[model samples]
Target chain A: MTTEIVIFAVLFLIVSGMGFVASRWRRPDDIASLNEWGLGGRNFGSWITWFLVGGDLYTAYTFVAVPALLFGAGATGFFAVPYTVIVYPLVMIVLIRLWSVSHVHGLVTPADFVRARFGSPTLALLVAITGIVATMPYIALQLVGIEAVLKTMGVTGDLPLIIAFAILAAYTYQSGLRAPALIAFVKDALIYVVILVAVIYIPTQLGGWGSIFDAAQAKFDKTPAATDGILLNANNQLQYVTLALGSALALFLYPHSVTGVLASKNRDVIKRNMSALPAYSVLLGLIALLGYMAIAAGVTPIGTDVNTVVPQLFDKMFPDWFAGVAFAAVGIGALVPAAIMSIAAANLFTRNIYREYINRDATDAQQASASKIASLVVKVGAVLFILLIDPQFSIDLQLIGGVIILQTLPSVALGLFTRWFHRAGLIAGWIAGMGAGMLMLYNVANPATHHDHFGGSAFALSKLGLDTKMTIYAGFLALAVNLIVALLGTVIAKSAKVVDGPDATRTDDYTADQGDPRVHDLEVTSST
Target chain B: MTTPRTDRSPWNWLLLLPIAIPLIPALFNAVEPRLFGIPLFYWLQLGFVLVSVAATLVVYHMTRRAR
Candidate 1:
């Protein structure tokens, strides 16, 4: 085996050990309860919560695909930076309310909040299903990230992925959320070191940033008009803005991101982390430049897969030992988020679906065990997603996932502040938004790839009957349709005297803190 | 049950600045005005990240004091 592969293997083994050891890191009074197993007993302070949430939001996908997008396209790929940049401020207002309400109600999932606030199990079920479905492709993308790194290291086929995911599944099944939370510290630290070194060292070695940009510009100038160029022209400008804003809105709506916030100890932790988390966006900006660096290095991607640019760049630029460390960073980055995504999805299934439907009277121990088993099943499904389908298709599904999850924003994020829309109206709006989004996604075909449907997130404004040549983000347009339908539906529902469900949450619940009377201790709840 | 906040604090309004920075695509959508050999589109966005971090920090401190 190569030195790179050997170092990568050693680092992976160490993280797997950490994942197993994490079950006892903050050992709760009872591991059999969902509160302890699913959320690290909801006792994480600022630092652990920072690493955990940071590690969760910025996945291996960010490390690989963002730069890959930049390497392939020109300026438009930088959308990841602005989207991540804006998301912190956006979530700062939104998530503190979510954290407060979830804490007061002892809620484990976003759907739980939806059910309580809207008093509609059907709406909550849709939220739950959306969370699960959105997360499945996201988890599969993590595997794809690892597969890219492994493929560059000359390890092909499914064995490496299966082995890696097997290790991840075992630890997650054994320890639940605690495993990822613990492993995140090491993962984040390694990624920071590797990225920092690459950003500083690689540019200097390649004759400075000027050459890098010059090379990138020269390469793009040769490509056809409208797609290439180092600058955003008028045609792609609207797509860039809408894509960034739509992503900012959709980021926190995902179950894993919500799960990260809900796992914190208090509102203060969430707020502090929000302020602190923008630091990653700075790192993301640097990482995106790696695409330009690849151009300067004359690093041709393996095959046509642009995701291989980063791995190939590192292999060409850095020494074998360091390349191994970089590979390990990407590989471990995949495991941390994948573990959290599966746990988040499993929590949704257990709390919102299984308990709501299958066994309403399940004990705490039963619920925890059910979540553990469900996590395994979710991981297996993600593995099959990568194995059975095209990995590129999974990436497209992730874009659609963003579009679908954004539809839930009106109900979940908006409901945290108001009950203005009737629950029925909100449900109707979700259907409208989802339908429009899917139809738009279906009609967007890339003739180059022979994908008759679901090709990408960008659609021409002309397709929507606008005369402009500019294309807009599908998610943003779908959201617009969703909101209009929801507003109209609310008017109709209110005039018709549709009976609204009872609100389970009180006014104070929206601002509840750790010491609040409504917030139950995990130990106390476990014994009940 | 405690009532929700009815009085909107001005400090909370500062948070909107960060959200507004990247929404205007025309602001930093060019390549000529490069900083340290990096494109204006790239470096300016990176600068916005720091601005956002500062805005968030200011908002967090002010709101926590209010609470």
Candidate 2:
């Protein structure tokens, strides 16, 4: 084996060891309980939570795909920076309320909160199913990130992926959320160091920022499309804004993002971490610039996958040893978020589907065991998604995933502020939002790729009977339809005297703090 | 559950600045006005990250103090 491959293997082995050892990092009294295993006993402080949440949100896919998108299409790819930047403030208002309410009610998933808040099991079920569906593609894309690195290293076939994931499944099954939490520290540190070095070193080598942008601009200017330049055009301007805004709305709604927040020890941990987490956004902006650097270097992407650009850039630009480190950083980055996404999806299933549908009175041990098994199933499903399906299509499906998850914003985010929207109304809103989102996704196609359905997130404004040639984000339009349907449904339900379900949560639940009477009781009981 | 602190404070209103900054595409949508060779569109959006972090920290500290 080459020295690069040997170093990559060594780093991979180190992280895998960290995953297993994480189970004992903060050994809970009842390791089999859902609270302990599913959420690291909800005892993580600000520093650990910062790394964990950062690792969870900024996945290996971001490392690979952001630059890939930028390399393929210039300014549009930078939407990710603004998306992540705005997401912090948006979630600051939304997620703290979620954390407070979830802590008071002992809710483990966003769907759990949905069930309690709306008093509608059906709505909660939709939320759970959406969470699972949206996350499946996301997990698959993480595999795509790792696959890019593996392909760069000449590691082919599904065997390596299956084995790598099997190890991830085993540790996550044994360690639960803590596995990713512990591994995130290393994954994030390596990524920060590698990216910081690459940004500084690569620019100097490429004859500084001016030449890099000049090269990028020159390349894109040669392209016939008006939207491919260094600056946004009239056509893409709306698409860019809507994509960034829709993505910000959808980010925290994902079960994994909420899982990361709920895993924190207290509300203050979340508050403090939100302030600190923007440091990663700075990293993300620099990472996105790597796409420009790839352009300046004239690195040709391997195959049709733009995702390979970053890995190929590293291999061509850096020394073999440092290239291996960068490759491992991307690979390890996949493992951290993949582990968390599976755990979050599994929690949704175990809590909402398995327990809600299969056995209402399952013991804590049974719930934890079921989640572990479901987590393994989730990993296998993600691997199969990559093996059997087109990965480029999977990337598009992630955009569709964002659209689907945004449908839940009304129920989860708005429901936090007021219970005014009727449960039936919320249910109807979800259906309308989901149906419209999926239909739009189906009709939008990329002519170049020849994909007939689910091609991309940008839909033409003219499609809605407008005369304009510009396109807006499909998610934004679908969300608008969803809100209208929900409002209309609320009026109809109210006039029809639809009986509201019994609310299990109390008023104080939304504001419950660490030492509040109700929160303290649950904490004391869970620890014992 | 009952709503938690429905009234908004002026400090809480500052959090809206970050969310609002990126939504207005016209503000930083150009390329001619570059900062240190980076386009206005890119650098301004990146600069928003610091502005956002600062805004969030202020809101956090103020809200925590109020409580």
Candidate 3:
């Protein structure tokens, strides 16, 4: 009805058409293999990988929820910058090794790497389950991004949301990872245009950067809490640091991110992308400032949804036509990652659970078919997560999702470096970390959002009997407990003469490149 | 272009610098000494992105063998 909505719908439909046709983009000889369907044939060079990975990592969540975070709570929202900036170099150090070894062993997922490196199917199962459950809320949250834009545009109801997922499901089921891979080009181009315009054009109209900061500072300073200022206070700085660090640690551990990485052509492609990926972090910084601009523009969210602040600001600040482009940037933005996530989750299920446990002798075509169906089921499940459950509760669960995924750090991240810990020790440590993380997450309450339990990630130190209001990230604390338990379990297992499990990886496998003789060939379908 | 594992350069350690730099709050948390009227807290963090991209680039090039 409105110009913005019309433009958004037109652009969205055109892109969905492109996604449908994307099955032919790189056309493998046999498109039904798990390698082709799930990973886009592992042939993306630097440029395509750049766009795909960028689109997948910086989601609709970054555009909608992040600025809303800044709109609601001031300085802590900027933690997104450090979280993304630090993640690349940290992951680059370990991820090339992951890329190399996965290629060498035909590993399709991180859990595949775990199964090979840890030699324990139980640990691998735990890692797989963690990746899947954490990603479900995340996929659902992407819809929230679209929902906010739609709600702001006067479009409401479950039908539109269901329609959006149906389109996403159709293209993804038709083309697999290639669908999102092709669609990401459009998503990133639109986002870059929208971000460049908003960051540059809007500031001049709303006085300037100084006034924006001043407004945000004034609003936060008027609040009684010490934690809401534009500058970090001592009380909440601990939360900021730990939350950022913990999030950065969890970023790549998610199955979908590894899907992006493992889909690249070779080690060099990954190496190049890591350094270049910070470009998105820089874009994220500019996007985060949109919150302050919203404050200066006097944009209030519709009712209680703080996530609508950025979209509402766009509607008010931009002409209706341009606002539509901004909305499309975010709406299309959700598709790239959500599609990839369901595909990744499906791959994990089909590879680790469905194949490893269900039918060990399942053929490649069967695995691909199963993954395609599982991807559809995952999408429907994500939609139900938003539709049946309270959407705000979905957001809270997404926060808890971060803490859930962090429990895999010891096995996924550290296991990339060493296999010294006995398999059972790693398993025990995971259980303790997961249990503690969940318990801590359950106790976190946010008076602002009015949730009594399972509210957020920041846990107060006083809860553990410390004399302070200072709180740290629950994921950070849970990870510390995990490492300690893992170390203790390792010592106990070692003294008890419990032998470490077999490691299928060789020392040289860590450094293998694309051309290395051991790197699994794309044409090889036989099991080792 | 693939360097052998035994011949890997020590320059790989430079990767840690960029990762560690952003974690230290005292380094970039200041509000004053602004850039383009933007606070140091904001612009300086964006500056760290450039710093990181540069560090990663250098390590990538230095370790990469000439074909």
TM-score of chain B of each: 0.80, 0.77, 0.82
Residue-level lDDT of model 1, residues A1-528, one tens digit each, is: 299999999999988888778888866788788878887787776677677778865676687877877787778888888898899988888888888787777676789899989899999999998888777767877877887898899877777687767777888888878888888888888998999899999999999998999999999988785665777888888888888889889889988888778767776667788888898888888888898899999999877666789999999999999999999999999888888888888888988898899999999999999989988888777777565444333344456668878999999999998988899899999999999998888778764456666667787889878888887889999999999998999999999999998899987778777776778644344333
lDDT (10s digit) by residue, model 2, range A1-528: 276798898999998888778878876787798778887876776677677778865676578878887887799888988888899888878888888888787776788898988889999999999898888767878878887888788876765576567666777888888888888888878888898889999999999888889999999989887767778888888998999999889889999898778767666667788888886787788888999999999998776777888889898889999999998898888888888889889888987898889988899898899888888888887776565445343355467678889999899999888888999998999999999998887778776566666667888888789988798889999999999999999999999999987788877677676766567423443332
Q: For residues A58-129, write the lDDT of model 3, one tens digit per residue.
A: 686788877887888887888888888888888778777888888898886789889899788888999998
Q: Which residue pairs show backbone clashes in model 3?
A: none
How many Å off is the CA of A423 in candidate 1?
1.2
DockQ-wise, the better of 1 and 2 is: 1
Query: For each candidate, what TM-score against the reference?
Result: 0.95, 0.94, 0.95
Q: TM-score of chain A for candidate 1?
A: 0.94
> What's the ranking of the predictions by DockQ, best on top?
1, 3, 2
Interface RMSD of each: 1.9, 2.1, 1.7
Q: What range of 10 consecutive residues in model 1 chain A has the weakest lDDT sum? A: A388-397
User: A-chain TM-score per prediction?
Assistant: 0.94, 0.94, 0.95
| Candidate RMSDs in order | 2.3, 2.6, 2.3
For model 3, the stretches where C-alpha displacement exceeds 4 angstroms are A157-160, A384-398, A522-528, B1-4
